[model samples]
Target: MLYTNITSINHFFITGFPGLSLEHYGIVSCLLLVLFLAIVFGNMFLLVFVKCESSLHRPTYLIFCHLALTDLTFGTVTLPKIISKYWFDDSIISFYGCFAQMYFIHLIGAAHSFILMVMALDRSIAIYAPLRYTVLFTNTSASVLCVISWLLPTSWMVGVVLDALSLPYCNSNIIVQCYCDHIAITSLGCENVRDVHIVAFGLAMFSLLVPLGFIIISYFIIIVAVMRISSAQSRIKTLSTCTPQLLITFLYYMPRCFVYLANNVGFTFSVPVRIVVVMLYSLLPAAVNPIIYCFKTKAIKDSLKRKFLVRKVNIRTKT
Candidate 1:
């Protein structure tokens, strides 16, 4: 699967959460199993609910549906391999598999970042200009944005994956991190990769930070508009819609920014700690997104309640 003659290492060995002992693998695997199941099923529930409930067909929920699908794909790309690594002691990944995983990992990361920005934009428009929000965030428009969100990241990562693949890998093929991340893979290059690292860092910043900046700006404008509302109740009601988004955004971005800072800025942290930080940002949001939407959005809550009540009534009638 070597696309180039430069790749001497034909495979990679991923050490899941370095510094943990043998016995700890079982515990860690069990925890990750729970997380993987939660991420998969939680996002699936969101997808099904969004699809089944016609009332939840607005731009906000549509964007969330897209987000749910992205989270599911993201977790699928990164988690199951690690779960296998810990559960079955399977750590070797083919070189092409490594490249493929790295590509999707970053691709999905970039996609979700853009999707969050889209969500923020949807919120800002809905609140700041409710009259035109419908016109602005129509289903067609949101679908187009969703397509762009998915494509842009794949396009961005094409060069990245090519660059990494072209690099000579005569050095050790051991990826110290949990998965075949760009940083973890590139660090094993046989030659000096200063320029490559520079480009990689630039791409990473563009993927994660640019959308993050947009989200921050969108929230800032949203806050100002919310404040201008004269009634306390009005302001509270308007602001409450944004609280869940802000919380989820924080949950998603803060750990990512921390990881970037720790990696590039020379902030000292143990390997296990860094891996934990990565997992926290990547998986936690996927697991919590459904809960956030269900609790925060009344429509989803009422729909779930109605379904439960109907099921109860059906059971009682049968009995």
Candidate 2:
């Protein structure tokens, strides 16, 4: 039954990809397994690399460290249940568990947006206020920003959690999506949710769009500053440093905004298509973030290369 009663609806069945048949389960499961492993290993490698290499303890790299940690925790909080749904055929989640998942998902997501905004500020300070950058964004300030990043998200999403909890979910227990999300869960409320929808969506957009706007403005200033540099080589060097951040920011925001629009605005898409878009935005960044940094940032690439070379020499010596 979709919903038996407020108390009775204790568990939810997660039917992933309504479009896929039983035959597609193996392929989908294998793919998700690969992505999960990559997200875990890639983010872990970046975190350890930053920690062991004291040279990367600068303000910007410290922010990168935070981003890496968020990505790791994001996947940890979200992916296992998704993987289990496919691999072990475990699709049921308890009521409290569902609310908890919803909270963490938004928590991580909101924190991520704020972290990216911080990164953009870091880049801007580096470019626009090069001399004052160090003094401005000292190790202490960076740590504070990191703390605020998590705290702000936690505070913001508390309302979302309360909103979900306040609603008596006696209408439907079936969440069409793969995981517990605010929209999907609240939709099952027995009462009319137009006000709830407005408030919930308003909070969601405020959290997402506000940071996004700051990022855009920061990048705009950074771009103008970059263009003012006279030397071609200097401009190239400055832009190269920003490429990884730019790519990751694009990966994070564009698809998310698109998904939001498709759902809210008049844009129409089939259920499976909508789910694919959502999953792409949801999963792609966690997988691509570390890869983008490894490719774009010389420090990260060089660090990994040095690690590999040292490992190779150690193996030879042992042999």
Candidate 3:
């Protein structure tokens, strides 16, 4: 997959959590396997519940369903390869495969940011101006936003991936990451890749901060609106609806911002520590999203109760 005359590395060795002890490998592998299953089933339950329960057909739930789908895709893209690396001792990934993995990871990262932003906006409008919320966050509008989240990244991210892919990689092919990532792959470039790094950092900031800015502003306004409610119970009830999304937003953005800033500012950390931080932010949020949704939203909880409890009762009565 060499696009130029220069000698490009054809394969890379993915170091799964650098500095990991050989004895601890089995423990880490088991944890990752459990995480993958959690992500798969948790999100699948959210998807199916949202689809089957007619009462959960509001725009907010629709957007939440899409977010669950995104999390499923995110886990699939970055988790299995690393799980295989630890469990089966398979670490070699082809150049194009590595490139493709890096591309989708960033693409999904960007899309996840926007989807969270949309979720924030949906809540902000609902709380800030209750009368206008339905008009603004219609089913059609939410669908459109979800489509844009997936499509918008496709255009700019191609250049990001191709830029790194075009660079001449030196002899070393060991990427100090669980899977192929832009920073890990670009650092192997033989020539000065400072400019490419700059472009990537800039895009990364835009993708993360722009949506984050909107989210922050939205929540600020929501706070103001919540405070104005005279009844203490009403205020609590209103803010509670938003707590799940706020928690998810924190999980996704805080570590990302901290890591990117730390790298640029020369704040040093061990390779294992950094990769753990990356995994926590990227994968942990997706795994936790379903739990948050099921527990926080009354609609989802009620739906779960109705489906499972009724089934149990029906089985007992038939027996």
| Alpha-carbon deviation at 99 in model 3, angstroms | 0.3
Q: Report the C-alpha lDDT of model 2 over 1-319, residue by residue, as the tens digit.
A: 4557545577877877886887878889899888889889999988888888988888778888888888888788777887898888898999899989999988888888889999999899989999998888898898799879889878768877897788777667788887888888888887787787888778778779998999999999999999999999999899888888999899999988876777678888887887777777887799899998887888888988998999999999999
TM-scores of the candidates in the order shown: 0.94, 0.94, 0.94
Residue-by-residue lDDT tens digits, candidate 3, 1-319: 1223447667888988877888888899999999999999999999998988899989889888888988999899998999888888898899899999999999999998999999998999999999987887899999899889889988999999989977888657888899898999999888899999999989988999999999999999999999999999999999999888888888888888888789779997787887888898889888999999999887888888898999999999999
Which 10 successive residues of model 3 have the least lDDT summed? 1-10
Per-candidate clash tally: 0, 0, 0
Which regions in candidate 3 have their CA more than 4 angstroms from the true location? 1-6, 261-266
Candidate 1 lDDT over 1-319, as tens digits, reads 2223454967888887877899888999999999999999999999998899999887778888888888899889998999999999999999899999999988888888898999899889988898998888898888789889999978769999999888888868788888889989989888888887889889888888899999989988898999889999999988888877887788888887776677678887787887887788788899998899888887788889999999999999999
Candidate 2's TM-score reads 0.94
RMSD of 2: 1.8
Number of the top-ranking candidate, with lDDT as the measure: 3
User: Candidate 1 or 3, higher lDDT?
Assistant: 3
